[model samples]
Target chain A: MKRRSAIALVGLTLALAACDNMANQARRNPYELPYGSQENWPVMPLATAVARDEPLKPPSPPPVTMALLERGRQRFDINCSPCHGRLGEGDGMIVQRGFPRPPSYNIDRLRNVPSQHFYDVITHGYGIMYSYADRVEPTDRWAVAAYIRALQASASASLADVPPDKQKALQ
Target chain B: MAIFTPRANLFMNAALIGAVLLGACLLLAIRVVPVIGYNTQERFAPEQPIPFSHKHHVSGLGLDCRYCHTKVETSSSAGMPSTAICMTCHSQVWRNAAMLAPDRQSLAENIPLRWNRVYTLPDYVFFDHSIHIAKGVGCTECHGPIGDMDLTWKARTLYMSWCLSCHRDPAPHLRPRDQVTTPDWRRTPSTPSGEALMADYHVHTENLSDCGVCHR
Candidate 1:
């Protein structure tokens, strides 16, 4: 009986040792310094200078390509369509739900504004609109800005602007 | 001088031994069976504050998972939508419905709605939503027919052994990046086979089951 008890103890010890014990595990306390804090990351000193000194325009509108427009459409649908409406008519679902309605891109004021103004608004935010710099990368912001210009153009385009071949189809 | 014979004493001893063995079996069954049974349909189905049907939104209206859980690809948490998100549609459509009273109250009071979480892992298990999504694991593999659920329940038995089963062999569970949110998506002839996907996603099986993979 004593021998049996000794063997049982040995088995139990081995079993316990094999089990995963919570020891020496990394502990993240609530007050601990967070990973990827802004202060720890590399800073671009020129960003502020660029924002202040640069004219509110890209030298010219980006070369209009179908691929770029498609990418812009996708990005605009995800980020901008929530508040700006899918067609940029300032009647998004959020606006219908009583959030402040932004001016339509088709309006004279927005239509006349330089492309750089739109880029600035997207990067730094304008009035009630929050900055999307964190959510939208710089290239994507340009893409969205280009898409907004396309939307404005579409809203005001006349039948005369349609190609002769496409005009027949429209009729 | 004893009242009973040696034979009777032996019979009594045998009966006592049988009783002890039966008692031990009963104790073992009571302890082990319940733990296994707890992961089944009856035990893990928790009630929520509001009966928000995923079926209505996903299957009926054709809303994407990202429409509500917007941060699933970007953040660790697949974020719960705020009252404003719900109100964007609800305010126009079901403006006076009794079911949306809590939502309206939350909006009026300027307080966030407290949603009961389903599919929560223990604090010790470090799971990242972005990594799983980026690695090509579809939502349905773990979440299970979320588009069909009326009141969502814990679909999988989120036990460590169940997780390790996938970690050991995750190839069969992966799909194309575009179809990761598509609940009913399957391996079509046009799509690459599971082995090719495993190579494409670079899902190396080595060190996946290491204790620190989840525990740390």
Candidate 2:
């Protein structure tokens, strides 16, 4: 009888311990779809669909502050640098690995393009490149355009263009 | 005929001693057993389809975590690289490697490759990658030295106590927001003090460990 009672106690504890019902609940993961469910496959919004979160107003592209540039650099490095290269020379790692080269930002054509053009291309991709509207937000798209302009200027910048205090570092 | 035999007294003593030893062992096991590597699943590499190595991709090639996990900044979950992201490089290099056969098949079939979650939190726990990242919690804070891991494994037990320990005193775990995704990031001399970073990130300790913070 003692042995039976001990076994019963063990069974009770095991049963109680095994109930992770509260922890698991009924939550479905964002990406995971359960079998037998009628959930549609997750897909990026088509070009015809609402792509840009906000209207691109020419009057107010967020003032190009240092913060904007910094954000641009970060977002550009993550999203564009793989294909566009760090310096925007179109020789990124992906290109080296055989993805078609994107136009160099230093090129006259790209340099002449307005920030609005850059913002538009990113919103709805250009040429072989797919739309980055999914990854980069609207404001960040402007930031990247501004950074691209900075990259273009740096390509033609001379030693004298550097600020005197910082010139020694470049030397 | 005696009320109690001397031999019975010895047996009683032995039984008492045995019971005390057994109780001590049970107490020790209760404390130690659950935290063992086997029970915790710490450092155990679950089998993956492609045997993708973080060491090869992260350390060897210097790929950023955001290279694939693009939604990490804005979303609760760090997005897994789609098959297209893998094929971006694989289509050019290693075009027909047997290891990447599943990757190609996944793309062709339009089915996502199922990756086993290394640090699956209980559904009740509201862990947001974006919040942790925005608040400057480095990946290595919980993920360990990912660059050195050939096959990713559970670095630490995702036990509630483990989560609360850091949530209670997060200064040590805080880093620069830029370095949040850097694996095995170490503090340099130039790095801000943990307290300074905590202040900069506007982290408040009071609500961090509240049960509602994680358990929703």
Candidate 3:
């Protein structure tokens, strides 16, 4: 009987120890895990001067390509169209819902600003807008900026801006 | 003198005990089985600050999961949409409806809406949305037909063993990266088989069940 009881005790201890493994343990929020973004990761140097009193332009505008613009359009529709409106008229569904109205991109103030300003706002956020740094990847930010610039130009464009070959179609 | 014979009394007591045991067993089946079974919850939809319908937004309006849960692809949590996101259209479309009063109040006070979480994991189970998304797991795999849900409930049992079943063999649930957010996506003959997807996504089964994979 003594031997049998000892064996049972050993078995129970083994079972309890197995249950004590890390998988069964409770973890806290913000767990220290691998593969997530880390603060120690290298940061890329700013490609454009920080915007202050004077507006700074990007070293060069991202090469305008159909694919880039398409990507920009999709990203903008997902991220910016909520507040900026699908056409960047500052009449997005959210704006209608009673959020603070952002200035229309078609406005002269926004149209005159360099593409870098848009990127800065997206990266750092402006006014009541939250920074989309985590949501919008850097390349996509540039694409969105480029797309916004196109939207601004198109908003105010005249028949003169249309290609001469395509002008007849409009007429 | 007695109301019944002793044998009859014994038989009656036995029957009473048997009925009690049967009732206990039924109670256990109702309460315990759902906790253990896969995708077997009774679909209890909790009340929320707003009656947000996933079906209306996702299926009717054709909004992508990423439109509101913006960080699903990049962060640990599938972050909730801010009140501003809700008002973007609500301010114009349903301007004065009583249903939108909470949203209007939240925006006016500049306070974040306290949305009740439907699906939550225990603190011990560390799940990352980005990793699962990058690994090609569809949103519907665990969320369970969210686009059809009028009011979202915890769809899957989310038991550890259920998680292990997928972690051990994930190919069957894997899909093309583009279709991860496509809730209605299903495997077709032309689509790569689970084994091919497993190879393409490089989902090695060996380390997936390791305690540290989720615990740490």
Best by DockQ: 2
Candidate achieving the largest TM-score: 2
DockQ of each: 0.09, 0.44, 0.17
Best by lDDT: 2
True contacts kept of 1: 0.03
DockQ of 3: 0.17
Across B1-216, the per-residue lDDT of candidate 1 in tens digits comes to: 988987998899899999999998898787666457464442254776568999887776555677677768877777787676686567666789898899999889776666666765665778878889988899999889888888887788777878999999888888887788887787888988777888888888998889998875
Per-residue accuracy of model 3 over A38-127 as CA lDDT, tens digit each:
453233336785534333433446698988898899789888887788899888666665677899988778878888899889878887
Per-model CA lDDT versus the true structure: 0.76, 0.84, 0.80
Could you tell me the lDDT of residue A166 within candidate 1? Answer: 95
For candidate 1, write residues A22-85 as lDDT tens digits: 6323544222223425252223255456544445744455687887788788678766776688
* Clashing residue pairs for model 3: A93-B88, A93-B89, A94-B87, A94-B88, A94-B89, A96-B91, A96-B92, A97-B91
lDDT of 3 by residue, B57-161 (tens): 788666779887887887898888877667645655677989889999988976666666667676677789999998899999999899999999877777788
Ordered by lDDT, highest first, the candidates read 2, 3, 1
| Candidate 2 chain B: worst-modelled 10 consecutive residues by lDDT | B84-93
